[model samples]
Target chain A: MVHNLWTELYIVLLLLAAVVIISQCYITYLFHKYEQAKIWKVIGILFPLGLNIYIYQIIKLEKRLNNFLQIASMERRDWRTAYLLVLAQYLLLFAVFGLFASP
Target chain B: MSKRSKARIIFFLYILVLLCFDTTYSFMIFNLFLAFAALELSFLLPLFRIRNNKEIVMSMFFVVTFILLSPNAIYVVTDLIHLTFFDFDFMEGLELKEWWNFTILVSGVFLALFYYVLMMDQVRAFLGRSKWMNLILLLMIILSSIGVYIGRFLRFHSIHIFTEPLTVVFQIVHSLDYSSVLFIGWMTILQIIICWLFLDEVGVKNGT
Candidate 1:
């Protein structure tokens, strides 16, 4: 009985992970469309486990974007807030899966 | 040196130092060597050209070999069971016993964690911007769990698949019982959780 329950939990967790990954990709797409972030860096963000790479790429783009805005004499909108929320969503999903599926 | 190369050097040096203290157990050294080889293969696997037909074929071979051997890294945890075979009287052999125990346990766990991180980073590099990143990681974890079982309980090394293909295939096909399924499932969950925690911490540190 316990074994069956664990197996079911595993399946559920796997499905949750799939959903989270798809959503992460979608969020990146949205950011790329509206914020003019580079498509390649946004694509790099899809790597679920490459958090360091993702942060590095995002920071690089943000810094460049800040310089461009400064030269253009424009105010910088808080676009990073959207990306942070998406990250938090996937992270919470991972924590939930870990908590429920651990033996 | 790059972060990845630095890690590889540190891991190699660590194994060398530990080998001095682990003289009684040669198999452990062999297992670690296989794990180290797998990490190196993973590091190289992502560099192949995905667009060129020849390069794609070569990279697929690397991918298959990596999946087959990466579990040897995780199987380090199972090596701790060997400690039960040793006879140690706490009062009589406390010093030697404690030292050996610490060496095995610490090295085993450290190598496992390092290999796990190395594999994850390499795989992410391979998957670079793929839409199915999470699904791929989940599948790799499931396969690694089964591979761990084949290594631990069946006493089959990764190279045995090449030398005794038929016997290895038969054993793996026959071992897919309910208990093994449950075992693999739990192990998959544990491995995923560990990797997630490690990567998340790295993300936090790097992001801040």
Candidate 2:
């Protein structure tokens, strides 16, 4: 019984995550349309993409071409790039449960 | 001196250590690891990539620990939040853990801007592959993913270490779905060869 409950919870959580991601993307898109908050446009757009890359830890970390991604021009470690991506990941995962718990 | 690489290495070490530590003690270790990850994150602060203000940092720590601890942790955070707000029922259905989670996420947007100050340029040198390194990278990815799956299974089964190794070995062989594994195995081999060619071309372009 407990196992089933936990599995159900896990599945619900994944669905919640999918909704939150899609919702956030929409809100970000709307903001982009409004011509408000220049800073958020870059972040609101790039953050999600950076995030999707980070959580994919199963994909071993080798060097991705920084210039290729347009994240940074140099081949060196893009500290800011890493943070934005990793942070987005954690936040998305964090907000997910709440999305499911509600209604 | 790329601290990023150093930080990555440290994070890798921490994960391995956490896996080896006794499960009961793992929470303490996990909180510590969360702190370490946060600290490593701080090195990026100067670049403004990761905003390091107090509220944001606390929220980050709280959320990281909250996730690391699991559901029962959900209650303790809720109770604490309730005590502080004096609203026993603030944000209905919002457990302390969930609320903390939301706060961290909401705050991240405001914090995203400080990231561009840091200059980056260390990566151009190593795109070419050693056939051996490619093989090792592939092996590590497979092993780590299996480790993750096994870790979850053991937690569910309530089984501890004496049997953990056995499960880990079983997981690697049985891990990926059969058809996908066959496809991925070949794909990975091809990737290594393509990567080698690309890196060689980049080298030639640079040498010009």
Candidate 3:
């Protein structure tokens, strides 16, 4: 039973990582289309394991999109999806590591 | 909210979550904080406009501090050795706690590398794109690898450079050997690959 639980948890974590990577890729596409996309942003899609979402957040907050029409057409919340996914990934990892285990 | 404020809040919340899980890892938390602080310093260092000789001197001081603290970020990668604590046989089932610990440790390692890359990116921007800037980055990675070696094997902290400068230097000189040199070279290569993949993509225009 314990082994099964571990497998399930591992699968969940893998799925979360995959979703985060996809979200990051989407964000990179958006940045490329509407803004002065950074190389780091492209690299983030290729290696979504670390720093991509954080970089996305930093860029989103620091600069406005070059094409105002694109910004107006897109929902504001669209830009935040990757950030939320990354946060969820961290929260899940920490919650399992910290709260579920007995001291 | 400002970028700095948002980053701080996220970092604070991360710490709070970790503390809530286990206070025994306070030392790890402290190290993470130090790495985060160094990353923030690097990010902020570029924004400072030097107006006079005094400002330039202060900026230089902060630059040195950033370089010294920067190694702590990469040093976190060495902490993966702790994962050996969860020794389990294939014959036996894995425990939930052990599995979670493994997950957390790997995540922490990734996060630390991420921090190192982000910090280097900021420093790269501060230095601008040039052959000399690339050389400086290579030099920084080599120094950081040596710093990791010193920290991991010598068990010396970065602060020791200021407090016990002679002993630290002496120990570093004496500790030189084939194995240590090999380790530093391997680490430097690993860091360069990471930088090449993440920070130095070819054919991509630099973002403003």
Candidate 4:
């Protein structure tokens, strides 16, 4: 019975991660459109496997955009709390999984 | 030398000492070393200015290699299952040799995790803390979790992806059951929590 509860919680956490990843992808798309970044770079952003490479290219463009447009970007701290909440949820998930998954 | 470089040197020395001390588990240390090397190469590859097609292709090759090997780092954690091989009985009291073996195994695991945390920090510093950066990290964790599942349960090494690509792919697809999903989910969450703890340490260190 306890194992079932942990499994349910694990599924919930996985669902939450999926939602965050999908929403972040959408946000990245919008950023690409607003910035009028290169189409290929944006396409590469959609491919999570090569994300680091594409991110490097997009960040270079963002630096140029920052200089030319003087647009303010979101502070890292703004996302810190949300990230912490996710981390706490996952840590709880890990603890439960560790406790119940072992014989 | 920079602080990061100093840390790398210290870590290397620690690995050497562990290698010398534990002959039976030297292969695990070697695996950890190779994984760390792949990560370092991947991190350094981006530093080179991409001038032409050849450079771009080479960089992509290293990126792929990095992804393939990254799972080995966390795969060491699963080595804890080998603890069952050792004798541990509270009623009989602790055995020094068994306890020593446990220490060596755990130290190697912790070193692997530290390598992972350091790599993440390096990537964050390179990309800057943005939504894109976080997304990339999430993708990496997800990929590594899948990779670990393949490595641990399916018994496929990273090189198998190159030599037996079709077979490896088929096995991975065939092995998609509830237990595999659960294992992958557990690994993903565990990694994220470790990364978060590292981030908190950086914040505290920087007085942010």
Candidate 5:
């Protein structure tokens, strides 16, 4: 199982590398075709920002799916249970704080 | 900017600030968020929609608790980071005066946890794809968290037998390795998930 997972990971990594190489190649081709090295430089500068944007998109999609689930099923109100969940969240914070806090 | 767009911008900027700064300003921003969340929840929850005593109680509880938890979040991270960076052992070796510095050290650590509970939904959104994307993200988070926990455990465990590095990796006996990378990375992603969840929740509650 581990072997297969590693194999998959390797393949995925290779594909990612390939995509980067291919995009760079395409961009270089376009730059030379248009004699616009300046544009290429701009693309290079913008790539990191693009990745951050991509990450932002993924987070948005995940929330949509979760909302779908919650909507379909009512998060039924049990005050006691709700209160407890609230309290549990609090306790988790408190314990974490105490563990690390200066008394 | 629309209210949400403004909030979204603030929220995203706040997250970046948290990751980058890990300071009292970040904590204050986060605490204010808890206050905002409490106010938002009061109006947006179904119980509040119905208008009852229960709603009032829940809102009050939430407001108070939110205030309490926000600081705790700050405390946890500050403490852990301070201790780790400054090399303060939690054991008997420390003088009382040194403890204050330790608080500031580990402050970044709770930021990881904050990402988990507070931001998971938003992260999922940022990383969102099909079910497969989510599954992959979940796995990544789990692995990174285990990785980070292991690192913390091992470094701390040298103080006593309980801190054994083996104990850190002992989860591997059950296929567990507590790692901060997994924890923080997963949490980083999770915060995105949470942002989306809040948006959705508010959207539904407020009507489109």
Candidate 6:
């Protein structure tokens, strides 16, 4: 039973990792598309593990997009709030792991 | 005064406290310190930007030492196996007795993670803007995963590369077992993931 739970935990961890990576990669794509930031593309490809870099890029990209739209008097919703959600999810993930990891 | 330096000092202080409680683990701490020092040497060498041939050769020496010892940082994770040896039998009325084991285990995990992240950053910096950076990162992951396996299950220390070079080579020449393959495979992937997460959170903002 414990082995089964551990396996399930591992599966959950893998899924969590996959979700983070996919979202981060998409964020990198958004940066490239909207901000014309080819440097993020280089970093995304070369240092694919730079999640924080991706987050930073996404935040900057959002600000730039908002600024560009604002010149036309159009308002864009702030998506930087996603960073807080990501932080919370990671904290919860660790909490779950700690709860189940005791042998 | 930098954040990294402050983290390093905290790591050492934690180790010192651990040693005070359990002096028998001095050898393990000594081995870890050697690995940490080798990593710092590697990280700092490139910053010097030596142009002369003599200086280049000296830098190469440090690079070799770093390559040999950096795996020891990853290898430190395997030292978690040592926790099984601790006497867990509870003594009544002993203040913070049972909690000591928990403290040691958590601190060791933090320290190992700290070392691994720093070493990975230094290595990426060492590789700096190479055209083949991706390929190099892939190569490092594979090689370091193998290095960790050899260090852990094969009982080979980094110093053995110098003292028993031939034996080390001979052992590595042999076939890899199933566990070694799985260990290497997962470790490589996880190492890359952790490396990505640990890099600057602000990304390339402010032209960093």
DockQ top scorer: 2
Candidate 2: regions farther than 4 A off = A1-16, A19-88, A95-103, B1-3, B21-24, B46-208
Clashes (candidate 6): 1
lDDT of each candidate versus the true structure: 0.60, 0.37, 0.65, 0.60, 0.39, 0.57
Per-residue C-alpha lDDT of model 1 across residues A1-103, encoded as one tens digit per residue? 7796577557656766665565566556544554554754466455554343335433554355431223221112222333333334443454444444332
Fnat values, one per model, are 0.00, 0.07, 0.00, 0.00, 0.00, 0.00
Q: For model 5 chain B, give the 10-residue run with minimal summed lDDT.
A: B155-164
TM-score of 2: 0.26
Q: Which one wins by lDDT: 3 or 4?
A: 3
Q: Write the per-residue lDDT of candidate 4 for residues B77-146, one digit (tens) a residue.
A: 8878878877678689877878887777777787777667766665565555576988998898899999
Q: Estimate, for each residue in B72-164, the C-alpha lDDT of model 3 and write its tens digit.
A: 888988888887777756568767777766666666677677677777877787776676998999999999999999888988776566545
Cα deviation in Å at residue A25, candidate 1?
46
Question: What tens-digit string does per-residue lDDT give for candidate 1 at B8-84?
Answer: 66666766766675445456666676677666556444333254554455446546766877887777766777766
Candidate 5 at B142: error in angstroms?
9.4
In the range B70-116, model 2's lDDT, one tens digit per residue, is: 21111112122222433437557556654553443222211211110
Write candidate 6's Cα lDDT for B42-121 as tens digits.
43433333445545654465556557667766666666676665565566455364456656665665676676776666
lDDT of each residue in A1-103, candidate 4, tens digit only: 8787667667756765664465446445444544465764455346442243325433553254331122223322222222233333333344444344332
Residue B148, candidate 5: C-alpha displacement in angstroms: 5.5
Model 4 CA deviation exceeding 4 Å by range = A1-103, B1-3, B22-24, B48-54, B200-208
Return the TM-score for chain B, candidate 5: 0.28
B-chain TM-score of model 2: 0.29
Per-residue lDDT for B198 in model 5? 51
Between candidates 2 and 5, the one scoring higher on DockQ is 2
Off by over 4 Å in 6: A1-103, B23-28, B47-56, B86-98, B202-208
Evaluated at residue A79, the lDDT of candidate 6 is 26
Docking category of candidate 6: incorrect
TM-score of each candidate's B chain against the true B chain: 0.83, 0.29, 0.87, 0.84, 0.28, 0.80
Q: Which one wins on TM-score?
A: 3
Give the Cα error of residue A99 in candidate 5, in Å: 34
Off by over 4 Å in 1: A1-103, B1-3, B86-93, B202-208
lDDT score at residue B121, model 5, on the 0-100 scale:
35
Model 5 accuracy (lDDT, Cα): 0.39
